[model samples]
Target: MLEQHATELLRHTVEETFPLAREVMTLDARQYTCPERFAQEKQQIFSRVPLVLAASCELRKPGDFKTVEVAGIPVLLVRNREGTVHALLNACTHRGAAVASGCGSAARFTCPYHGWTFAQDGDLVGIASSTDFGAVDKTALAMKRFPVTERAGLIWVILDPDSSHDPADMLGGIDELVAGFGFAGWNHIESRTMHGPNWKLTFDAHLEFYHVPVLHRETFGPERSNRAFYFSQGPHQRVVAPRGRPGDTAKDDLYALGRLPAADEPFDPLLVGEWILFPGASINTFYLNGQRGVLLSIVLPGPDVGTSTTTQTFLAETPPDEVTRAAMEELCTFLARVVGDEDLPTSALQQKALATGLLEHVRFGQNEGGLQHFHRWLDDLLKADDAELAALLAEPCPQR
Candidate 1:
């Protein structure tokens, strides 16, 4: 979907690696904040990447469905009577109107525009006037469907007509990384969306642990050490930070910090794991033994400059013990606040600078290797010739 010229620029900008010790990384500023580049990314990144689009599980039973948008394309996710998940264009074939308005369970969808109806399986079950239409092939009029693949408890979709890559293949090392956390049995909890700044900025904020000690000082400052952050590579980049031990504090202050009973009660050490899928998907997992959870987020491009949306879904072990579920909910709420209240505002400010054109480039330090790897990957994607890009995009889906 990216323009030819912007792809060329992205290729040219990402050709060099900035060394961080023995690790080589690349950083490209234009790709992040440039309007033309952003447009190109919407087409190439969001459309071609299955991991960004297809991911779902049953909220209830058969006939359950949810509607979502990717990059700007409206999508309807439905579980048919057979319990197989299907991703279909949300638009009605009748007049291109969205068939379903919101997320809910439905036996069938009828277009408000013309009374054309579709079964839960996306088949055209009724035409307002079948006999009057005379020999119109209803089977051929089924809702346009996209490719959907389910893996590791998530459903992924590919929107591009020419996309030949499998979501699992593009996921590369992320498959094993996710397995390391035992995510297959995780249950869906809640999801929230935040709008501000570009999605890339939100992802950039998560790609490093350097900001943890500073940005999270009020909550985690006393317990965490900045130097403890470390990174590892797979299909994507991963950063792990060990939770810090709480320091001396008054009893009331301890209660306010969510640490009760006593300071010496020996609380579980926290582990924050982050995954940066090539392009712009970020998944952050937090472990606290009884309070394990994961946050899957995507930075989807809007229709203008300096704008993007962040959609986050929180999942935990389902059918959980009441206490564990309650605790996980509280923790997820807290994390969402940290992102909505703290990180987004800062990212918006960064977008302001990017739009003003006063800054041509942003710098990355040795500690931000994940950020560099993401940029380099983007460079490779944009620079690749159509054939090469197609090959990279069409890599076979990993076996579930």
Candidate 2:
């Protein structure tokens, strides 16, 4: 975040502490309910734009790899023996069967269909029954690769092979703001997937703190203010909530941390709140048993507008001690309850209501600038003309 932006937000926070009427934003219901729009989004926005695919820590070392699907395209990400990351189509060169699934450290991957093997760099190294199968150029058959750029301990990939946009152009130096979080040194603890309705609804929930006092009442508690300070780089954004209550007497373990930070200590506020790495990923802070933890929220869009998936990854700055490990486990369980019990269930109901078409559009308050900015960015891409769209795609897309 720029110093000017930070100061401006602080000023707003101070002013908004009172009961002031703020401008509100209207959002269309079909944005979440229409299948045709979803399909278009899958093609024009999701496929063409550079998305934050994973935290660089997910591939910790040489030969470490993870597989994910983006815009319904199977992606294989690997760090080669020389420590470079490769993002390639997970399809096998032989028959298009995925050569890998999940995460692990593997010297090479072999297609299960016919046992064709490839190294981490997608080099075809072995082919079974060569005499009978005939000879082909192995180099020509390397797994189809995608455009992948890495910066600030994060990996971004464009799902469309033909798209030439750079992820750094999407980031536009926003990485410098949160690079201080030490994500590069964070150790990935665990990942669990859950189903949700509409990627936008789920993402919208993460972008604002407005629902905290109500929806998260049992989790975040009512005393905490339901407000957020917004900072964005292009379509990517970061929402900062107040770090902790200085003099409160509540035991609110928000972020699923079993305890709160000592309010007396001089602390940095920017590192304290939620960061949305847009398209799908959030970096949130947590402190459990006195050890720092980061909750990496990766939102995976499902086959249609009606469904979506979320991958919540827990990370620690260092390997946790037994006590800290136990605290983390407890935090994980609490997070499951909060999301599965509170968040997604409500989003599913919201989806159901939106599908009724009774409401044409909903509103977002002035404080919800992040959500407004996101929708506007989406609309711009979806509504751009031929030449305008091409030029938009070619340039850096950090939102003003």
State the C-alpha lDDT per candidate: 0.63, 0.77
lDDT of 2 by residue, 1-400 (tens): 4444445555555565422225678888999999999998998777776777788899999999999886578999999988899999999989999999999999999999999999888889899998899989999999988888878788888787766665565565657777866677778888888899999888788888889889988887887778776666766777766444534322232322323335663234435557777667888777776678888888878888888888888888789998898889789878878888899999999999999999899888877877887888888878765345545644435434
Error of 1 at 335 (Å): 1.2
| Count of clashing pairs, candidate 1 | 12
**Least lDDT summed over 10 consecutive residues: which range in candidate 1?**
1-10
Highest lDDT, which number?
Answer: 2
Per-residue lDDT of candidate 1, residues 11-41 (tens digit): 3335532224334444455655777887777
**TM per prediction:** 0.79, 0.88
Best by TM-score: 2
* lDDT of prediction 2: 0.77
**Which segments of model 1 are wrong by more than 4 Å?**
1-28, 53-55, 58-60, 131-135, 180-184, 227-235, 242-272, 287-291, 390-400
Model 2 TM-score (2 dp): 0.88
The TM-score between candidate 1 and the true structure equals: 0.79
Q: Where does candidate 2 have its weakest 10-residue lDDT segment?
A: 249-258
